[model samples]
Target: MDSGDVDFAHTDEAARKRRDKAVGLARYVWDRGIGGPELLALPDDRLRKLARAAGANPPSTRETWSVVAEMLDEKSRWAAVHPDDPRAVPAHADEKIMWVKPPLPPWPSR
Candidate 1:
């Protein structure tokens, strides 16, 4: 096979690996109920190490970071409803912003 074909195959394999890892991580988080704040609080190096230990095959550094961010978001939303949960609300003020605009009715008021 040509070098281009070889590279494509390798890329495909990597993508599949990443997808598998993400799914696994998602399942673990779902089953364990480990809050996202805990994950976000981890240092980048530490997070990467945890991912490796968790058997994640992140396709790229960017993707790895994104996964961490997603975990945090999920944890935050869950915690918001679970008062006893320890996960703090997301720190980003913008993320917490809720518009006060009135909701439109299904039909115009007569």
Candidate 2:
């Protein structure tokens, strides 16, 4: 991905920091034998406690779930980009597409 493609000026530092923290929390859970499925299976109260235990401020049930969902989304994007890696599991191929050049500037009309 080209850095130039992004509008860094408009980027939200706060949101990025939050997401980064969430990713770290999600990773911590996974490393501790609690991946997405296990996390989702835990009761709501337990999930809130889990978030607090991870040092994340008292997040609501919805916020805790969002962390899992966001982490899963990031994971899927990673798998899509690294299909050949042994650790990458295949997600639904329907929504995943490998890179393709933009259709614009239509390959020099010959």
Candidate 3:
């Protein structure tokens, strides 16, 4: 079926089966430490092969890399500051600064 023509509806039994499958896949991945960057960096075809070997469908390599990059960025940011440093802590003191855009004057009429 075409992407737009695919049906999203599922019966109760089908939903339960899907949920069970997902849980099983999650357990398998967790046990194998599948979230690590080495696995995340594998090519899409290779990832698919790995996932099939693990009995789960693999997502696109781009999606996997995006997730890996986000996790690494977060970890790096956290590691940059000392735990006891007050200045290292993120503050909400200027949350409004991002939304405060400068006003522009009206354009002259032709």
Candidate with the greatest lDDT versus the true structure? 2
Error of 3 at 29 (Å): 0.7
Candidate 3 residue pairs in clash (backbone atoms < 3 Å)? none
TM-score on alpha carbons, each prediction = 0.39, 0.44, 0.32
Better of 2 and 3 by TM-score: 2
- What lDDT tens digits, residue by residue, belong to model 3 across residues 6-59? 454455775565555445443444334343354455566765655575576664
Candidate rank order under lDDT = 2, 1, 3
By TM-score, the candidates rank as 2, 1, 3
lDDT of 2 by residue, 1-110 (tens): 58669764336874575576677666555434344555566667766666676687644435546766568657757767997985465332231222111236758768
lDDT of 1 by residue, 47-96 (tens): 56556655774335556445645765665577678867544433332421
Worst 10 residues of 2 by lDDT: 93-102
Better of 2 and 3 by lDDT: 2
Give the residue spans of candidate 1 off by over 4 A.
1-10, 32-41, 56-60, 68-110
